[model samples]
Target: MKKTGITLCLLAMSVGLTSVVSAQTQLPNSDFEDIQSISGVADNGGQPYNYEYDSLGQGWISGNPVNRYLEIDHIFMKDTSFTHSGSHAIVMRTDSIGPVVAVGNAGLGEFVFNESNPFASIVFGAPFADRPHAFAGWYTYKSVGGVAPSDGDDRLINGDSLLILCYLTKWNSTLEKRDTVALASWTSSETVTDYTEFMIPFNYFSSDVPDSANVMFLSSSLGYVADFSERPFGVKGSTLVIDDIRMHYSGAGFDEYAELNGTAYTVGKKVVVRLEELPSDASVRIVDMAGRNLVSRQLSDKESTFELAYSGIAFVIVRSEKGTLTRKLYIH
Candidate 1:
């Protein structure tokens, strides 16, 4: 008993020390707070979901709201079972989370049952003009009926499944049609036994969407396993637990620095400050630290090698037909 007590004390001390180090480093999740929550069906005619606080105090089992809400009794993994109607939607209140997703309901068809409600679904993690860089969670379907319905006999099965998506607010408020960005995909066969990690890049994102995306929706796309179709879909009779749905600002994907090829020019001769990759239709202006334009030249496709008798720290702003890229060089 004395040894166990010592071990516990040591562990607590270690945690304290680690916290101090993290505080100095300004790491993420330091002052993090769970800002927004969407679960267990608020009384405002909202979606139904279940919030399961795990033993580790880091997870929740919830349903996607829109269809049917269900409760599981601990037979499967994560949090027992999933409800389809709940549609497992939660809006995180992270300061640096992502370029968020939005919900739109513009041109949805008329609702036969509920005339006021045209459609019901949510979008997740679409970086429109406002937030062009986004990241989101992944889902995989694992029911018995093999994801697709044959004769429309209730496409969802009694097994296990997962749905993951984000809401881009390209549509109106009817909830019928909206644009979506699929970050990663997982089906029961792909993620169950061998699934570990997935990655999504920003260059592959579509840039034609608008900038009014602010809400996130996670609904079962009808009964389909992967809902890539831009129509209204529904999810019911299952549960999903989402954790670590975050965004990463990868520093502009490529090096913004202009490569100055020193080998192309001879050092013996005093040459002008020139660049080979300067755009043909660009205006190149070389300036000193005091904002004085020392040399100005109209560039072309060919490498421009000029004579620069002066040598110092200089700035080169190249305005090309494509865009403007700036760089600094030390002329020795």
Candidate 2:
């Protein structure tokens, strides 16, 4: 409780300091406020299958269930008359959570529903011109097994997980990819019964300002489970609700660690952070609660320790070719 509370407080205090350079263009219809149809009936093998309205035309794409594999979206995960912010929120559900097996995915850019190659369900990058620091949103999740789905010796335990992906790209038209600038992925199996805030902090892969971005949201992390030849997917009947998604330009900085000398500490103090398996080029920065950089260093070893200075609830943003990790640190 202390950890969660303290973190939330710091976030609230730092909101104004992390200035938004330019308003991140909201992913077209991100709030799920445009409800063309709350309920709809679709044809499935000439059978009447009931479904809710999805955000296909509202800047999202999914599989061609009629001709390809099965896919759908926005399963009334929001409260009956309540919304996270606007008039509504986006909902994603999987077949694992219910009697039906539906792939619930929505993302910026485009989705290629590959029938022959499920792995080919590649979501191409979208035109994005901003270099925001992170992706922010609120979400809630639910599942039956209460465990993340796992695949083992030819069997599945009906696991379900949520996936959020943000990739910075250079837009290579020849190979049909962003050329890879920076990327972040969040995959969790834990059931979140409440709407929780989340941020996808950007970690540059190549220092190049990405000309395009690709972001994805999924109710089922394992999209290939039904193929039966790939890794096992998670349980069915899982659902997720998302709302108020945004990308930010700045905030002085945020904290990611909360221990100094192995004891609870206040901000604006000093502490040491130890990380293992770091690449030689790994970049680590210590930022104040206002998102101000205080310390910066580059790692040249497999394992290293950083003595952070001037910290009271400071954030340690570590960037490597692999990915970025942010830990909260507290000092007294």
Best by TM-score: 2
Runs in model 2 deviating more than 4 A are 1-24, 38-56, 64-82, 96-102, 111-115, 118-122, 146-159, 173-177, 224-232, 252-332
The best candidate in terms of lDDT? 2
Per-residue alpha-carbon lDDT of candidate 2 for residues 1-332, written as tens digits (9 for 90 to 100): 00000000001100001112234554556676664433457688999877643333453444322221235333433354445786666676665324324555555544434456453444444556557777778888875454433333322344456777666667556765335555555666678887788886665545555666566666766542324344325455677678877775566353222212211123345444445455566776765432334666785655445455442555566666555565555555
Q: In candidate 1, how many Å is residue 317 off?
A: 34
- Candidate 2 matches the true fold with a TM-score of 0.57
Each prediction's Cα lDDT score? Answer: 0.29, 0.52
Per-residue lDDT of candidate 1, residues 1-28 (tens digit):
0000000000000000111111112112
The count of backbone overlaps in candidate 2 is: 37
Error of 2 at 2 (Å): 47
What's the lDDT for candidate 2?
0.52
Task: List the lowest-lDDT window of 10 residues for candidate 1.
Answer: 5-14
TM-score of each: 0.30, 0.57
